[model samples]
Target: MTSKVDRPPTYEDALQHPKYEPNQLHPGSVESQPPSYSPGSGMYSSSPPSYWAQAGMWSVPDLPPSGMPTAVPTLSGGLPATNPGEMEGSFSSQWETTSVRHSFIRKVYLILAAQLTVTFSVVAVFTFVDPVKMFVIKYPGIYWASLVVYFMVYCILLCCKEPRRRFPWNLVLLGVFTVALSYMSGTISSYYETKAVLLAMGITAVVCVTVTVFCFQTKVDFTSCGGFLCIASILLVIIGAVTAIVLSFHYVPWLHMVYAAIGAIIYTLFLVYNTQLLIGNRELAISPEDYIYGALSLYIDIVHIFLFVLQISGSATE
Candidate 1:
């Protein structure tokens, strides 16, 4: 009798045959293949086909273990493996903050430039033009009246409904304030000789530009001395009042020069302080929302600086 040889079970035969489970023991299979299914097999022993069974046992080839990393669970919206939004959110927040800060600074400087231009133009017109000069000189009280109007308009803008304070209203209030300030500045400039006014303006420009450049370049923060500046400003105001009273009694030339010198120094310091406030990245950073306030602060500083320079130059000529 001829012996019948059983070829190693093919994968197709393994799939079709009920006795060829991957986990079961089979006598003719390779060591990696599980035994054939039998009556004694446990009901829970079913699993995926073994490598040796999937390939015919003798035909199974050697392969190196896979080097690729397993897939990591992703976030919703197709974001990366980590919480994902945290990094993007942080970057966007920083970009927005930087953009707002720069915009605020630009708006403040532009408004200040407009205010200065208006002041200079009004002063020039009133000083040089006969009709304007005559009108301003005839009604000196116009300056004081404009000041009152300015205060009222400013207060209304500050205290009124949000809608009233927006758009054309905010712009109108600012324009009114600027016009009032220009009138007052023009009236004051008329008191000085034309040459003295021009010289004072040039000097003021040089000093203001120099200090502004210094503030931008230097690491030294002038805002740190806020308390000192406040106290000094108060003392200067008292000194100015006293000086005014002394001048009313009798004009002391040396005292006038001293007063002008002191005023210039104080206002220069104020310029430094306010520029620091505008540009500094501190805890008390000027809010982008407060562009009007920022412009107001800088405008006051420059105007005072110009006034003191005029006083000094006018007194020098005398």
Candidate 2:
């Protein structure tokens, strides 16, 4: 052994090495081809191309050929791909929701128009007819009968299933009955008292419109006050009943007038609170039936406020 050192290959010698240009050396020689290399393995000894390098060619791995099985793209672990149909379906669902909301709003406005027409017509007829004297003198029974009928209708609405189905026709009938009875009561009390009723109506209209506009514009939530207001209403009703009974024994007209003024103020507060709920709260998403209920609540508030204001103003005129 002479212990001679082995020399390093020159660049030209390295270029001609068997490992260099393996594909070219094995061109058209299938038997001399290099073994297949896995990604990330050191066997290839070269960096992979940038993903953007193959701009037009198929980038997804293991995708089937176009003519064979349909190719589906997925994330790692193979979840199904998002398709155009799914996107379209989502959009359609959103549109349907919006349409339903618009339809609900339209129905509410239609019903509100009908109610206002009925109410205003009744009030106008009563103003002209002036039947209170005849009702009071000849048909004293009418007052009690009207009260009974109103109570029955209230009960029916509270007890019935699908109360909305009966609402339209029942409201029409009630409007007619109420207008007749109210006309009789107002006229018999005094024809001059009609001016008081008109004044009350004007005040109520102004207050309702103003508060409703404020509620709609501000969009402030007032549902939290609902429970307190309801409790206050019950207490007011009880107090009113007791006071009426006591006043009837004493025949104190002035005390009755004072109560009327107080009642009007309470009812106006109710209108403000209820309007806030309708325009401000998410509970407004309730069905048309609920909208009717809300309208009825506000209607009661307005009507009571008007009656009390009329009674107080009439007493002042007397």
Candidate 3:
């Protein structure tokens, strides 16, 4: 039996004009098409078209639709895209803020220095001057009066921002508060031996210096410790009340000493916290406008440290 071969068709085996363009040549056909021939020798070429000016071809950028900023990473190997004019203004604003903070800190410290000077001066005179010492020792009522004045002024400064920020009046109230605190400190110092008082002063100075330095250098964020410190302050007050009540019946030397040491540590932390608040650049910072309040906070911290240190020393000596 003979079999037919399944061979593929080749170009040579096909007839010419096999595209079947029947409608293209028909005049009335709606699907008319173009002819690749020239009627009167209008020339045609296979070259690509060209334009006078063309946009650049770039890949899709890894950026938002708003276009990429001129800014570049500081450590990266790219030139900065910031405008020169903008850079100067940005730097100026930052410098201005920094300068304001520095001046604010300087003013607060000056006020604090003056306040501490008045305080220690009063303590010295009260301790050394026999007549003044005897007078303060005789009239404990003055100490109570100082307490009242200090509290009233403290409340005014704390609650009334206007008064704290006021010009001459702010200074007046601050001086009054400082003097009242000085008297209270002086009276307390008068009750202790001179050597004990001096030792306490020295210890307090060292602690304040050390705490302030630590606050400056350490990365610890004490501003968030506000709530904790507030609770601690309340607890310390409660402890003070209990100590007063307990000592009314029995004088426990060790109890008072322990309380004094604890008070010292707490207030030392307060000094550190407040110092960081004043220094700025923290999570919580005191406004530069509140110089009076800043001074008062720092002064209070140092005074409490002195008071607790004095208590510890006086108890030891006695």
Please list the Cα RMSD from the true structure of every candidate, rounded to 1 decimal place.
8.4, 8.2, 11.0
True lDDT of residue 26, candidate 3: 42
Query: What would the per-residue lDDT of candidate 2 be over residues 1-318, giving only the tens digit for each residue?
Result: 422344333444434686543334324555433323333442432222334222322223455423345656656477555678998999999888767655655555565556556555555555656563444546657656766775666565445536534767656644554454454344333443567767766877887788778766775566667787788789888879988899878967778887887788788878777666544344443443455555555666766776777787777777
Tens-digit per-residue lDDT, 19-114, candidate 1: 655554557756544443322432223443354355533221254224425566655568545545887998899998888888878988998899
Which TM-score value belongs to model 1? 0.71
What TM-score goes with each of the models? 0.71, 0.65, 0.77
Q: List the residue pairs that clash in candidate 3.
A: 70-81
Alpha-carbon shift of residue 63 in model 2 (angstroms): 26
Q: Which segments of model 1 are wrong by more than 4 Å?
A: 1-85, 151-165
Judging by lDDT, tell me the better candidate of 1 and 2: 1
